[model samples]
Target: MIQTILLKQRPTGRPKISDFEFITEESDLTLKKDEMLLETVYVSVDPYLRGRMSDAKSYVDPFKINKPIYSGSIAKVIASKHNKFNEGDYVSGMLDWKTKQISNGNGLIKVDATKAPLSAYLGVLGMTGLTAYLGLTEIGQPKTGETLVVSGAAGAVGSIVGQIGKILGLNVIGIAGTDEKVNMITSEFGFDHGINYNSSTNMNAAIKKVATSGVDIYFDNVGGPISDAVLFNINKFARMIICGAISVYNNTELPQSVSVQPFLIKNSALMQGFIISNFSEKFPEAINQLATWLADGKLTYTETIVEGFENIPKAFIDLFDGKNKGKMIVRI
Candidate 1:
């Protein structure tokens, strides 16, 4: 039987495990021509998934109630009637939160386990990495010697953005929720400096202390107060890449925070918000560059893997708690 988790109820504030329900069904192993059966190997637990939990209008349609939640997953093709994918081929795609999945194999991409760990396709070498790449280069338009500050700096996209900034010879300052994350960003990811937002009483002052020259590029994954602080430190003509707003995703009411328009006008800066699919046309190019960087040892990544399929909901809820240091993945 295939077991799956379904969104049982819409959550208010931070999500709880009670908001999800588990069910089992007779395993659907039947495959028609051009169809494949996949066994989930790794399920991604990301901040963006939080927004999808609501019925609100967004870039992607909200997950329907009583249906299995879906996100990117790395799976092994256990059975296949498709010519493109043979049994034992590993693939990555937007799949359900079930142990077993049946697909027509339309969006699945074949992945090589030898080139990188199968799970890396769910993270660094996949959508997360592409988000950082296209967002930074295409939107932020970073240049050499500029100062870059990234919110949610210890997370999947922010960590990669900071590392890529370093590779581009920019000074990188990161903002994370914990001292541990702050330390990891500077020591492990080669960021220039990291601020512990949880410990700082005056975020603006703290950022000013380190970024004395003001920020030239801000890669923001967390919005709200942290973004307000970053906005106050922007240099003239600075660029802001608005990624995930993890801080306000769980809010039931309209989220309010310090305004950014004044700073945008005063500095003649640019702040652009984007969904990664905005650059879907160039994914092949982005993936090739990220894989090359990984092979060349010019880039590094991290994952906080939770074991077991049943714990998928817990893994996702932990994202709001800042429990993972990097990309959070459920290893089934």
Candidate 2:
């Protein structure tokens, strides 16, 4: 039998286990010409998937009720009838949350387990890395010696952003929710400084103290008051890469924060929000660079791997509670 997870209903504020339904059916294990059987190996659970759970229009269509919920996943080809793929090959792409499934090999790409771990393709060497590199270089336009601050600095994308900033000669400061995350960003990821937002009573003052020269670039992942605090210390011509707003993703009503208009006016700053798909043309370049950095030991990544296919929804929900550091992956 094959097990699959479906969207039982659109979530009401934060997502709950009740919003997801698990179904099991007899396995077919059959494939037509130009098709292959894929057994899911790794599943990526991201905060942005929360946005898709809502019915509102956005960059991507919402997840339909009672339909399989898909995200970036790595799967192994156990059997194949396709000429382009062979049995025992592994591939990475957006895939359904099923224990096994069949595909015609359209968007999927073959991945080498020897080059990097299968899970890394869903993280540092994949979309998470691309978002960090393109969003920082293309949008942030970081220069050497300038200060770069990253919100959610310990996360999948933000962690890579901070490391790339350091590699590019920027003074990097990271903001995380816990003391341990703060320590990990600095001690493990080579960030120059780290701040625990949960412990800081005066975020504005804290930011101003550490970022004494003002922030030249801001990589925002969790946006809300933390981003508002960053506004007080931006340099003239500062660039803000508005990535995932995990902080407000589950808000029941409109989220309010300090006005950014005045900050931009006074600083002549630039704030741009982007979806990684918009920069698909530059993906090859981004992936090559990220791989180079990893091979040179200039880059590293972390993953919190959950052990069961049945726990995928819970692992995703844990993202909102900051339960995982770096990428959250379900290894089945």
- Write model 1 residue lDDT over 1-332, tens digit each, in one string: 99999999877789999999999999758899999999999999899888888865663678878999999999999999999999999999999999998899988899999999988898889999999999999988888999999999999889999999998899999999898999999999999999999999999999999998899999989899999999889999999999889999998888998777888899999988879987999899999999999999989999999999989999999898899978999999
In every candidate, how many clashes are there? 0, 0
* Residue 274 local lDDT, model 1: 75
Q: Write the per-residue lDDT of candidate 2 for residues 215-294, one digit (tens) a residue.
A: 99999999999999999999999999999899999998989999899999999999999689999999998899999999
**Stretches of candidate 1 exceeding 4 Å from the true structure:** 56-59
* Model 1 score (lDDT): 0.92
* Model 1: worst 10 consecutive residues (lDDT sum): 55-64
Clash pairs, model 2 backbone: none
Note each model's CA RMSD in angstroms: 1.1, 0.9
